[model samples]
Target: MKNLLYFFLLTFTVVHAQDKPNILWITIEDTSPQFIGCYGNKDASTPVIDKLAEQGIRFTNAFSTGTVCSPSRSTIITGVPTFKMGTGNHRSNYPIPDFIHGFPDYLQQQGYYTSNNVKTDYNIANEKDFIKEAWNESSRTASWRGRSKEQPFFSVFNFAESHQSRTMSMSFDWYVKNVWNYLPEDDKIADDAFEMPPFYNDTPEMRKQFARVYNSIKLTDNRIGELLEKLDKDGLRDNTIIFFYADHGEGMPRGKTNGINLGYRVPFIVWFPEKYKHLSPWGEAGSVTDELISFEDLAPTMISLAGGKVPDYLNGRILIGENRSQPKDYLLLSSDRADNGPDLVRTITDGRFVYSRNFMPFMPEMRYIRYIEIADITKHMRSDFKLKKLNTLQEKIFKTRPHEVLYDVENDIWETNNLVYNSEYNAILKKMRNQLDTKVLQARDILFAPEYEIGLISKNQTPYLYRLDDAKYPFQDIYNVASLSGLKSKKTAKEQIKLLKSKNEIVRYWAAVGLMSQNKTTLESFKNKLMVALHDKYPPVAITVAAIVHENFKTEESTQLLKQYCKSDNMDLALMTINYLLYVDDKAPFIETIKKVHDMPNRNYNVKAGCMDFLGILNIVENTSKTEN
Candidate 1:
């Protein structure tokens, strides 16, 4: 009788699990909404994705937390923003708290089998273990088919057909074989089929390269169609909630790594089957919602759908189900260092307008990021620039950006015009600016702490927790000093110079950045103060001051200091010093110093890449590093 009772209990448990809804996430890489038919792009040929939007809920305003792949995926996996986790930089591998694992761990606790079809670039220090704990199976062949009979499963199939390489980076011949050839003749996009974005020059060479965007997305759509067919073939279509979306924005030159809407916005759709239609917060079939959603919201929403408890550490809102939170007023987006490029930019978008603060105004939107710089399209643009073929607007990518920029993205899809200086929109800009400040302070954003300092603190404690300690972070003090970075005026210069005497090294570091951002005339007046700061105890501060003195005053002393740190044992410091040297007009003095660092054994790849870029620009040698974008 006891054996019979145990058998009955096990049967009941399995039956209960079968009643739960299955969740399927169909994710594509490096795509933007502007290139999709559902988003009103006439030139797009994405029939499968458009069908999902037609039969499901199409989100009009969705965004990624970060611009690049790993950082953005890091936020999607953990229900927290990269800024708060100290994982804002691309592929930084910073450690978070032990209690914080992937959100799928919650679903598993709720008796659901979880599978990820082999793309776990979570960007955490303990990635392998994290994946093992989060999913029942995570491999190319892993699937929900492996689950027990009648047990509900949550599976993610990530398609990389639309990644940056196929879209732009790889050679055209490779693209033809991999992407274009896969599409039907009718689906294949002609070179002149689509209108190019105004940002790029409208030459035939440019158009030929731009066609990859359309063809690659079409091939990705074909893959999506195949997966949907399998779901129906298995007779699980009615029981599964299908989610179709891209990892971030388009993989185009400026779209992938930039902080603007073109980089952060993504295509998001949720198709609720008849059985799970009640879970839709917005209506049932073929509904369109203008609600603001971000990558940070994915974890909590998925956990909520699985009928699991959402951890307090997960700050994202539950987007669907009975626990659906109210819509957000605005979304905060961030972009940090990617590959050999070092930048810090934060943006706030309220669905219609985008306001950006370029903390590192010294770097251009199209700076010498080795990953993008080596691309054929980038080479084409650079060639046009050298030949004086590009207009002023096209040339803007190569120049330093302003401290702040505002755009009515609704009206200006290309985001070419700046509204920050417009008197008519001053009130709107001020409100958005204040919102960003409040959000950053409340989150205790760890990215405000330099990457080198984050490394130092992570040795003793995780940067995620270290940011919360007011005594250790002093975020307000650091933020105030950093905010004065790009303001070039008498008052601002005087204030930054005074902050150079602060006890905090980070504060002094920003002060040096502020002084460096000033014009040559302003820097000349403060030469004495800068000369003292050039020998700052903090290597980062010294490096910034060195760049200023060497560039403006043409002093060898400052260049010598920069060159010494180029070979510093600290790779972060070495990378920092090398980036500044890349901007200097004369590369003769630092040639040997750069080559030595590049030849150093076991040097950081990014540092070596930076040195390699410098040498390549001077016709010394081509960069041969096999580092992935």
Candidate 2:
């Protein structure tokens, strides 16, 4: 018995030793490389990140698959391209493949206790089972300590301070009052020195916007430093392999959570004190590697470092030690939906050259009002185009793009100059086009197929627009939807209704969506129209109608209709019905319904969570009501 115990102990020790490097992935929300001192941003003071870069490796040319949080994070965790993961668009509703496991999940399988700091917006079918524990920043440290000591740990900490709506009014004012005074007279003050991107005009308001952004980044840096200090206090610093990165690009005019290079390109730094000296296959400490890397590579790299086998389904390569090869021959970046501009654009980049394929080429540059509103410089430029205060070179970059574009990054760093028209670049452009075509085909992009479908169904016998050619005004309906959302007066209701009759299903859907926000009188005519839409072939339209009805009306007829639909053979419609029922009366029945659905063995966790969350919300509401009563 003693000898057998010794042998088992020896085996456990060997396995434990192999997995000593605990991964601590620190992700910042909506941040860009420009804020980090390690990335050569002298204006920003990011000592914590700078120290980490010095200890390990800082990747200079890392790009995210998508510019937004959901798609980028989904690609990172799945070790697959956004398109392959069915998360090519924002807020994806499709089920996540079982084979696609998050790095933390993989680590847990290897006996590591994995935890996350509250944010898990991977846009997966179900998000509950992804992490072992999730807590707000305040409780994250305590939660980490509460984990079992026998197992090594993997923890992801996300800092949300830098997120848009940078609510640091006091900090912003301080920076303006103090930091601005320290700079030399020639040094560009935020009010004078700030230059807008190609899409915007140079204006003082734009400069102030830049200043506010800088202050937000500073606050993020401070929080990151605090988290690092906690790791040290807990004596986990030496053993932890810290990886720091932003979810996507900075949220600004052209960069605001879009698929553009400025939006997707991010900073990536990895530091492991235990293996610091030995893991320099790429280069020395603080050495910036120009090798193009993407978020997809992160999961495989983490898994490989944890002494685990890389699953064959993962498309990314491990980027540590001997595996430091040149980046993918051509990296693909894509965007689908955000705000009011439902545009689709894809780009192929080979470090030196970038080729963009715009599916919606006719969409105006400033299709979304939010983009224009926040873009102080663009607003100014559009207000007075006659002034020509904006440079012509910048104007060309801001103007509507063509179906195809080629940029030599070596010469045009800002991607301002298009070399596609040049005869000399024709061969390069052709090669890139072929590569993109082949990649899309290989990836099984739905759009590339002969019978490409837009995943919409409507019974109104409307003309369904299908085409191989790129359409420019695909986002006009989206813009109209925005107008409806912002409408305050009854006078605009008729105009809003007119916009809802657009040929695009997305437009009509948004119009119906906008009606839900109005008063009873405004929605009276629209409600009957919406009820008629419940029979619309499109599941989303039906689901939206059901939701609106359930929220506004608690009639027995409506409840019966919802309950009947909830039992439908079509799981999509059924799910939508259950969601609507949750918004209506009788908490007990709704909770029971959710529990019954959740108890099913084969139902997806997301489906379960969708039901369970309603119960959770009811519990909260009940507690609040009890206190008040």
Tens-place lDDT per residue, model 2, 1-629, is 99999778756854674446766888887777766678766666566778888877888777888877777777876777766545655665545555566766666556566667757777665665653322212234433564555556777888876665452223345544644443345433344433344555556655666665665566677678888888889988777777888888776555645555667778888776755446556666666677888887888877777667778877677787555444567787777655323456677888678787765443434433233344444444444443445677645544455657787755665567778789998899999988876666555443221101232211221111221122522443354353354343466655656655566655555555555455566666666665666565544455556656656654444455565555555554565455445434455545565677667766643345455545554654565566556
What local distance difference test score does each model get? Answer: 0.88, 0.60
What TM-score would every model get versus the actual structure? 0.96, 0.65
User: Which candidate wins on TM-score?
Assistant: 1
Q: Cα RMSD (Å) between model 1 and the true structure?
A: 3.6
* Model 1: per-residue Cα lDDT over 1-629, one tens digit each: 99999788767766777889999999999999999999999999888999999999999899998888999999988888889889988878778999888988998877788999979888889899999999999999988898889988999999999999998888888888988878788878999999899989999999999989999999999999999899999999999999988888899887999988999999999998888898888996899999999998999998988888898898788998788998899988999988878888889999999999988888788877777766789888877776668899999987888999898988998899999889999899999999999887888888877788988987888888998888877889999999888898988999999999999888888888777678888767889988998888888888988988899887889988989999999888898888888787767889999998899997988998899888867752222122111
> Over all chains combined, what TM-score does candidate 1 have?
0.96
Error of 1 at 580 (Å): 1.5
Question: lDDT for model 1, on a 0 to 1 scale?
Answer: 0.88
Task: Report the error of model 2 at residue 424, Å.
Answer: 3.4
Where does the lowest 10-residue lDDT sum fall in candidate 2? Answer: 456-465
